[model samples]
Target: MAERSEEVKLLGMWASPFSRRVEIALTLKGVPYEFSEQDIANKSPLLLQSNPVHKKIPVLLHSGKPISESLVILEYIDDTWQNNPILPQDPYDRATARFWGRFVDEQIYVTAMKVVGKVGEEKDAAVEATRDLLKLLEKELVGKKFLGGERLGFVDIVATLVAFWLMRTEEVVGVKVVPVEMFPEIHRWVKNLLDVDVIKKCIPPEDEHLNYIRARMDRLKLKSV
Candidate 1:
């Protein structure tokens, strides 16, 4: 793979699933970039300048230009790299991919958050909602190996929250959102996503990631107390 001449920099936090999305995409396209580990709490000047509107990490700086937001950054990466193509060439297929990517953001992740640290009737209701949301995905995935069909695409990258983060959150909170028998399609999709080489490189070691979540949740609990 020929490296891009322009310097590429990624402003990201390791714990952020969004940042992980950018990392996976760059690795898949074999794009070389400098990773600037940002202290979001402190809000680095460069990070602020790059993403003034969102003031968020996972900003991709290609040459002197800045692209913010994980989803928007993802589109920019695909357009710029033009290799290993994250979205299918077919117009309808590309549109389908975009729709699902938004669904993951708007529906899946938002619904799953309701289950985190929630209890009693609220937790139960949230769990049910999450189940319903996942069922839609399970149906879509019935005849396909991946959400992206043959390759890891935009939908697969965006669904990292479902594939990895949600499972970790469930372990920490002891609320099981996905069970193998209940969500076989999601389970299979996750297994296939984990098997992807670029994904493996981007995901933090299981022990490290789990420990981080455990510590973060403990902090949250203390705050509530």
Candidate 2:
């Protein structure tokens, strides 16, 4: 694998699932980087400078040039390493993998968040929609060990929400958003994904994440009231 002597830094918030995706990818690829914690509420000049458009938590700085957005960062890291390839080699297979990765973000994660953020009928609708989306993903993973198949790849990395975020969100909301029996494939995939050393190590501390979600839930409740 090629090595870069230029500095690599990750500007991120500790409890951010998006940031976790990039950290996990870099770790898997054996890329060395400095992690600078960003207080997103009190955004630093550097953070603002790095991602002026979105002002997002994760901004991967490669030799001072910034790459914003988690999914894009994952692809960039995979392209840089080329050893522990995340995306598929074949063009069609690569496109398929990218599609699922996008689905996890655009469809699954976004809808699942609504299940917790909303209340009563709205929350119920969001939960049902999320379930239907998961059903599609489960079928997609019918005979596969991972979404990327046989190993943790781009899609598996994108699923940091299932492996880490969802549980904390469920705990705070006082609902089992994704019941294990109902989504057995997702549960199994999450288990396998977390078993990987890089993924496991990149996960934020449970208590910290739990507290963060609890605070967010409290705010959501206040908003509803």
lDDT of 1: 0.87
What C-alpha lDDT values do all the predictions have? 0.87, 0.85
- lDDT per residue for candidate 1 within 129-156, as digits (tens), equals 9989999999989888888887788898
In model 2, pairs of residues that clash are none
Off by over 4 Å in 2: 1-6
TM-score of 1: 0.94
Model 2, C-alpha of 12: deviation from truth (Å)? 0.8
Total clashes in model 2, counting residue pairs 3 or more apart in sequence or in different chains: 0
- What's the true lDDT of residue 125 in model 1? 95
lDDT of 2 by residue, 12-84 (tens): 9888889988988888888888999999779999999999999887999987899999989888888877888
